[model samples]
Target: MDFYELVKQRQSTRAFDTERMVDREIIARILEAGRLSPSACNAQPWHFIVVDEPDLKNKVADATSARLLGMNHFTKQAPVHIIVVEEKVNFSSGIGGLVKDKHFAFLDIGIATAHICLAAESEGLGSCILGWFKESKVKELLNIPKNKRVVLDIIIGYAAQPLREKRRKSSEEVISFNTYQ
Candidate 1:
């Protein structure tokens, strides 16, 4: 599919076929898309943890109850979960440090996650960007160090049903001509 078509087709999938498993090759392709995303000064301070184990998925679901996304329960239905983590570093002190901006790391990670989502969609997979977990609890469960922060979590698998209609605002409503209103 074309880029525009893929963008329109991609939607947040909540219900997935629990019996289906995503192939490693496809998962690798998704990860590759994320890894190739451009970063500020090429810091590349992101790490991905792909979870396919059933027990782990349950634990993640329990940790994610603080946020709601309809009837689509992530920890129970998704056969695969990719947790995106950002490795914090002092870019101001590093060599070739054009990235004096502090929030660039998070921005870069978001871009990477977008790439991953697109790639998964292109491969005929359904995914949802999950950002509702308790960060400290997630870090403890995943054994992430203090230097790294969880940026986002993505659930991927075959959708149990069809994609839902997307709700979005038009460009006319969101875009500005030259300056803020």
Candidate 2:
């Protein structure tokens, strides 16, 4: 698929085909995209934990559910979850961030994740980047160290639903020339 088309196709898929398992080759390609993504000073302060085992995936999905709000209940249907963990930034990236007054690690992780979702789209898979979840439960379930932070939980699978048109502001409304409007 063309890169622009892939970007257009990538969406936060909420409904997944529970019966269909994503191919390992496709998942590997998605991860490869993330691995090659650029980071601040080449720090690459990120680690990915792939959750595909049914029991473990269900456990991770459970952590994402909010019974009271009835939200993210669909995660259980997703066949794969990629947990992105924040690792310590490299020395130069840390220094650069401190000097520039910006959190480059977060930016780098976001970029890598974007690459992941786009790659999934290219591979004919659906994906959603979920942030609303019980971090402590996930940490315990995955045996992630206390020093590490779970940044994102990306659910991946084949979509059970068709794409909805993207709703967004027009270029004139969102973009400006030379100065803020």
Candidate 3:
């Protein structure tokens, strides 16, 4: 499919086919997309942790869900969870970030997350990028270091839900010719 069509078709898949499992090769391809993403000064301040083992993935899924708040309850249904970790930026990127007063690492990771999602779509799979979760619990479960930060959790699987119409603001509402409105 074309890139625009792929973007239109890609949605935050909330339901997944638990009976099916995503292939490891496909997962590697998805990860490769993220790895190839550009970063500020090539710092590449991120790491991806793949949780595919059935029992462990379930535990990681539990860390991403909150029943009381009704968020990410369907994460367990997805067979794989990729945890994004934030790492220290290189000297040049760090200096640039300080000079601009911007968190470039987060921005780069966000781009990588988009690449991963698009790759999943290209591979005929569904994905959801989750930010709200019990980060400390996930760290314990995955044996991630205390000093490290968990940036995002992406769940991938065969979508059980159908593709719904996408609702968005009009171009005029978000775009400007040359100056702020």
Which lDDT values do the candidates have, in the order given? 0.82, 0.94, 0.96
Give lDDT tens digits, candidate 3, residues 88-128: 99999999999999999999999999999999999999999
For candidate 1, the per-residue lDDT at 38 reads 86
What does candidate 2's lDDT look like per residue over 109-172, in tens digits? 9999999998888888899999999999999999999878999999999999899899999999
What order do candidates take by lDDT, descending? 3, 2, 1
Can you list the residue pairs that collide in candidate 1?
none
Ranking by TM-score: 3, 2, 1
Point out the worst 10-residue segment of candidate 3 by lDDT: 64-73
Cα RMSD of predicted structure 3: 0.6
Separate clash counts for every candidate: 0, 0, 0
| Clashing residue pairs, backbone N/CA/C < 3 A, model 3 | none
The total of clashing pairs for model 1 equals 0
